[model samples]
Target: MKRYLFLLVVGLLFFNFGNSQAYYFPERNSNWATKVEASNSFNQIALEEAVRFAKDNEYSGSRDLRIAILKGFEREPFHKILGPTKKRGGPAGMILKNGYLVTSWGDTKRVDMTFSVTKSFLSTMAGLAEDQGLIKDIDDRVGDYIWDGTFDGEHNSKITWEHLLQQNSAWSGELWGGKDWADRPPREGGVHDWKFERPKEPGTVMEYNDVRVNVLAYSLTHVWRKPMPIVLKEHIMDKIGASTTWRWHGYNHAWTEIDGIKMKSVTGGGHSGAGLFISAEDMARFGMLFLNDGKWKEDQLISKEWIQKAIKPSKPNVNYGYMWWLNKKGNRHWEGLSENIYYAAGFGGNFIVIDQENDLVVVTRWLEPNKIAEFMGLVNDAID
Candidate 1:
């Protein structure tokens, strides 16, 4: 009886201990430790803790977050693949934009919603349209096309493409839904009832609005006379050859907001938060393409001059550009970031940070939500 009791106690202890340890999300051969140099600053313990937290919540680290680490090591090598055979974590594959350090993180095959990172991709598309004379200028008024009654008035009609890019349009419509994504109308009289009337003036203030961007997408489609997705494929994705796949959620049916309000049903246009989907490494590849003056493997995907213009701070906001946000602090807009470090940030801490001086692109995704800035701070400290 004592022996049986002893075994029972031991088993209980083991169970408790096992419960105490955070669950770890497993990836095949994810022993990146063998690849990282001793001199590198990444805290392996911290990363492990993060992974465990992700797993404990069934957060889908790769499914939701497309994070990977790479370096030029002699002993260990990297792998590449596209989407998953099963419910995989990340993308199908990635491309080597530039050598050992230039390689992208592929193989894990995680694919999830990449939210606002879509805007950065869209900015490149706009740049291409500009370069090809498909669009006149960023400063052009949105009222010229899409005779939507929204921008038809005198004050509202002055809203420019640049205003939309910078989030300076000041068009006060519905912003974000907080609770149930399915209950509210997407827009008023759109496909549903959640339609936007009008806000204040153009380029007068800065308020983050996703529906405004949808309008930009519509404008692009109207001018190009082709689906925005096709334009993105031909101009940006294919040009870079990044070996990744993505889809736009569509203007009317992509998402159900946390507030139960669906934006697609309202405006018949997809908003910023629900439109984009891509892999973390692919995102890094895209960021690097920008970092290298919009060149990819000896091909100039975007004009260097245009890339510079895109990154530069805007007149009104000082921290946002055409679908791109600038990292400015000391100068203005409270960006509170170093000049060299810029990021493509998305909902739930999805980020692709580009360090121009360091020649590095750090991609991270956290299913945990709201902890991205903290993790990014840690990554920043490690790399610096």
Candidate 2:
């Protein structure tokens, strides 16, 4: 009887100790402290190799980013992109272990355009809308909320918030000078092939179209009844204690009237220039929130169910989520990376990789696409 009682006490103690060692927020203003006090079959050498890889393999994409974006979209040259972009950029990133900054490189502090990584943040805003009941049901017809002719046609009328989130809505027409078909035309097709292609049933096929993502942005603006940046700042960024240096932007022509006031409808990506411009450290903090299943410290910034929903593969594209890229079966999938590993990816190889299995988060900028798997594999090998 005494032994049984002692065993019960021991089990309780172990449970409490295990719970105490869970995740925590990193210090806001300080450089991350290295916990690699000892070296060996541990991550010290792996960290060194990873740093070297980032420094050597800079993005091999187009040197002139603005031109690349414009040509990709087949759009006219505009005076300026909607968001701020630096004339220069270099390899930058941060490694987080159990919600603490483990290491970082380059100008992680410099605010640079994160491009399509903005989509993940936009996805977060949509998750927020769902959490606050601003959007009743993602599966329901968004036409109920947005009465504009945007989703009015027979094929389009069937679109739901889910379809838009998945980029399968094939939402017709134009927004802010960008056309649905022209945003990112397939390399295999001519202009006529793209323009004349009939819209597929929602959720039947997936296409990566920035204009449709922008439609989600515009619709979300209506649902929240505020500029997306304002909503993002108030609810997500500030709540997580993000630095004041970050900026979110929308196109100059995207502004229009809503409820007797004008608001700018933001883009889902920086293809035309304007999305989330932020420091790597802040990006890590944001990734940590998702790593902790959408919790910030003690406040539940977003629900676990929503995180599950966001990370789960969309029917049309197993590699894509609400906006996050899954390291599963898509072209970007890495054979060595865990299936559960997912990321917020942008142009020029910018990535915020979440490895929940390892309790690690890695944010990188200007990382070449071809070398991603190689880099990720090296990091995995570091795990002792």
Candidate 3:
């Protein structure tokens, strides 16, 4: 009886292992397969509830994104839209389970501006650089690559690739007509106070400053010796079978010469303007790549090691990891969800959530920011 029971247990283990290896990946320009009627893995009513919640709780910001950009960041001094802004569409998103489309709302093909979610893409560029040996190590000083005065000062010189990736660089500088002190100054402080304040040690405090992020972008442009968008397309997007509609934009004045050719340095976020403009479906594809440990079909577009490092929490911010937001127990934690969940989030409710534990990828656009946790929780509750 004991031998028979052990044989049954081994058989079950092999079956589960074989099933886990059967994740589907969509091809370029191909329709993503749906499991709505075919699969009984999800609670259909609960899944519908998640979709309804996302659609009903659309972002309150103006659809005319130019007006939204200016008004949303009105507190910043001299804030101007220096890059292209497009009017966004209604609430649009998709939920994928085991790489199959489970449910989606709005026009999934409509290309919309994804604000700071661009940071995660920028972070991926750094990972690619490291994977290709362009960046020897994340701990290496940024000043070593670009000797331009950007990282000259004592405080800025101490900044490393990891520090910038973690948003704890605290590098003080102005770029593309945006001042470091003026980007998003504290509510209680004036320009004089912010400008004169000493910067914290690199890798110490996490501050969400766009100027610093742009600096990282500028430095990476030098490291890769090409426009970031081109690198992204050739290295990641193309490999993942992303659509042609996606674009990565930089500020009008962020152009610089590299290898005797001028290339625009893209912003990590859409603070003043311009970042990644992509369709919900493309974003889902990118999330799917990350969900599969940076692999798409037979290709490992990005190293598994890089993806692991990208999602691991930094010491300075447990909820942040190389521009990706963690669902860890912090201020941004989504209650009742898996702690292993991580996502790319942008302003005005753009999100690409990767729930690896459940083999789920959720892309949400124009959702009310505060309602994300609840919406995600509802989606989580749908799994059988």
Candidate 4:
């Protein structure tokens, strides 16, 4: 009996030890820890090659982002820089392995515009609202909460939180002087035809429209009853030990009254201009929070369930999730990379790739947008 009891206790001890995590978390306002010898986990030559590849293939756009925005989107009708834009720095990025800095290049601390990577952050806001029960169900009609004319129409009323997050709400209309149909209009159609066309049923198709994205931001603002920036700062950024330099912005005319006080609604991308302006390091930290399944050290800032839902493939687009881009086999899938990989991508080549299986978080800025797949392939090659 004594011998049998000893074996049982020993087995239990081994099981508990095996389940314990062995990752690191950087403290607030301090330098992140780095791998003492990166060679131990990564092939030094391959890793160096990845960094060099990123630096060599810088985005070929005007560093003055205002010019870049206007010129880049010139194909779209009535596209204009409607919000604030900043001159961007050269290529900068960081790679974290098991929460330790593995390698970095360029000015990791330089704050720059992150463009549509803001969408992932905005999606987190919805996750927070759901976690707090502010949104009882994502499937619940958004009109049920806002009640404002923003969601009054038959088509618009069908938009649920999930549909908005998935970019498939097909919520037609205009906001902040931008018409929904004018954004990335059909390549073949004229303005009149595009405007008069019927919008697809919510959840049936995915359309990447800035006006629809802003509608989501506006609705979320009403749901949170305060500035979305404040909610992000208080709930996620501060808790994750992000820097004070990061800022979220909306269009110049994007103000609305909330609780008797006027507040500016934030945008999900920098397509027309302002979204998230942040440093590469801060972005990596945010990536790390998701890398560990929404847990930061001892605190679970966002629930694991929400994180799971955020990364799952949506029906309309296998390559998209709740604002996060999945690497599932699809149009945007990176060849030779794990299908489980997910990332947040923005214009001007900003990306935050989360490879949970390998315990990696890679944040790159100003890389050539098309070069990401090749760069990630090289990065993945480094992990021996």
Candidate 5:
């Protein structure tokens, strides 16, 4: 009888521990829990001060953020910088610990172009395609499905989905009226000399070129057999319970036809214009979903294996993953944050930082770029 009672007690302890480990997802109504209820490990005052500090730093962005990027980067013609854009909010963010809102700042409802953070969403779509067998092998030459001249030519044909995902595809091309050299020209060279520089082998050099990223976007469109936004709405955004206010816009001139149907090819960044315009709440949901290893209430939205590979930094750039930014080597960027942390960062100071170990998801928009580290450090210090 004593042995049996001891085993029964052990079983009860394990059951309670498992129950404590489960997450408490927040609903859409106003009943979301407070910081105290959401987290027992973090100091509430520290969290509040962190948010207050972030809110106080809201005005650090260029007074006019709409064309601030243009003022910073003079590569593209001002007229060509077109598509969809929005004036940013002050500082905005949603903090989640164990899937509950710990704190939030600014206007979570404001929808603005998230810039290159769109690359992470684009990568998610590619992941969804791979998960559903739409993409047989990431190593397969992209030229196989995309018969268009986009992936043709000797060097270009050697490029694969992995190469593009890693930003090393060196697939030479001008798409959406943006040339490779013109996208991100050298900082210290004459335009004439930069444009004439010889191209390198595919998968050799890692260049953050939107033209190449757009080509990858266009290639995925053919494989999925539909517009990417539609695919995302059906498969990801809708599943995560995102709001209807979000949008993913492509350039008006970037239309491509497949199977007698024509659609606009999306971009991986809001460079010239148009990218992901989503609410902070929605982006928080995205980070939370990823924090749970691509699962949403037992539904494996994406494979765990793919996510593992997605977060794993590429060979050339340990600081970058499929489309995510990793803090590899512990000092790649975030000083006080853990090396295990990764994020989706964008221009105009947008971020979706995920720290699975702490069960934290932080979404910030329109904050000062330089102050992000300090803000994140403050948040981390709050945790017990």
Candidate 6:
């Protein structure tokens, strides 16, 4: 009886430990546990079909073409973290160049929180605003755009619009991370008391910062005389003929799951990231817009010159553009793009790669952390 009780106790302890080891975030849902059993969920199958369609049209694979595709997906640390959740509620729909349905990969369900990818969307809208003379050039100062005293700090007031776009605003990024200013709500605090760490002179360096983009978001509203979401819907989404079923989760950053499990928005960008939920097909259309110089079916959504200037390499650094990443060698032999393929990437494997020179736009959405290198190798080999 003693031995039997001991074994029973051990089993119970093991079960308890196992339960303790269960990995879960505060916002994980049962839907995430529900995997997509169909092979049609992944965009790869669709991409293969798209490739075959292009091949039928006498378009042979070139090293340059593949390189552009691979470079777009590869070189990002965030893309690797999207594979495991592939079966979970992720990206819906797929669109490709070369004119084909690609493969079936679920419906055009507007259920995806494309993180920083929204930044690219916002950036494009800002560019359009500039073209329409609503705002001035990228070189305009923040004060010039949002005169409501948002940028009225000693150092921050001097920050320019280009500085925010370039990620070189020199403002302390920690301020927005809910660090010392947790009690202070963002964008509502006193501008005079805002403390910023000026590492280097603005416009001379590049540092990825979300607060700067939030500032950009605020600036867009100030200039457009409309809410940011309304601005986007009116200017970009409607202009691009995107589905109106989408909703921007402005606050609370909760995921709209089938069940009651409210998932908090991870990655980055509230509206910049968690706000804009879109279908992969619409994302592909967005990519194609950039691919075709911001023109959709001969209707110019944005000016051709604006598109050219946005993707073109920035001065002093060829690795980044306006709200986009460029394929440029950093230090090692990492040759990403032969001609700097511009890509708009989002967290959780959301990618809309536009290789203009190669006439390619590849879109992918998955959930696997730490599988980026493996997928990147596949991408490189396939592209090569």
Give me the runs in candidate 5 sitting further than 4 Å from their true place. Answer: 1-21, 28-31, 34-37, 77-79
Off-target runs (Cα >4 Å) in candidate 6 are 1-95, 104-110, 172-199, 252-268, 271-273, 315-317, 331-337, 367-384
Q: For candidate 6, write residues 186-252 as lDDT tens digits.
A: 3544533444322466777665655556656656655665555676677667766666665554433
lDDT of 4 at 61: 99
lDDT of all predictions: 0.52, 0.81, 0.90, 0.92, 0.82, 0.52
Query: RMSD, model 6, all Cα superposed?
Result: 20.8
Give residue 232's lDDT in candidate 1 (0 to 100).
71
Model 3, span 1-384: residue lDDT tens: 999999999888556433644567899999989754324668989989999999999999899999988999999888899998899999999988778888889999999999999999999999999999999998999999989899998888898999999999988878898888888889997878988999899999888989889999999999999999999999999888899999999999889998799999998989788899999999999998988888888788899999999889999899999999999999888888999999999999999999878888999999999999999999888887
lDDT comparing candidate 3 with the true structure? 0.90
> Which residue pairs show backbone clashes in model 3?
none
Deviation of model 6 at 281, angstroms: 1.0
lDDT tens per residue, model 1, 219-297: 6666666666677777777666545466655633323332343333212112222356666645655776776777766
Rank order (by lDDT, best first): 4, 3, 5, 2, 6, 1
Model 5 per-residue lDDT tens digits across residues 108-227: 988888889999999999899889998988888889878868887888889989999989887786787788878777678787876788777777767888888898888899899898
lDDT of 4 by residue, 272-377 (tens): 9989999999999999999888999889999999999999999999999999999999999999899999999999999999997887899999999999999999
Q: What value does the lDDT take at residue 379 in candidate 6? A: 37
**Candidate 2: tens digits of C-alpha lDDT, residues 2-79:** 999999998885564234236657666766654432123246778789889988999876657776565545543232
Candidate 5 global lDDT: 0.82
* lDDT comparison, 3 vs 5, better candidate: 3
Q: On lDDT, who's better, 2 or 3?
A: 3
TM-score of 6: 0.63
Which ranges in model 2 have alpha carbons more than 4 Å from their true place? 1-21, 36-41, 62-64, 71-84
Misplaced by over 4 Å in model 4 are 1-20, 37-39
Q: Of the pair 3 and 4, which is ahead by lDDT? A: 4
For every candidate structure, what is the RMSD over all alpha carbons to the true structure, in angstroms? 17.6, 3.7, 3.0, 3.8, 3.1, 20.8
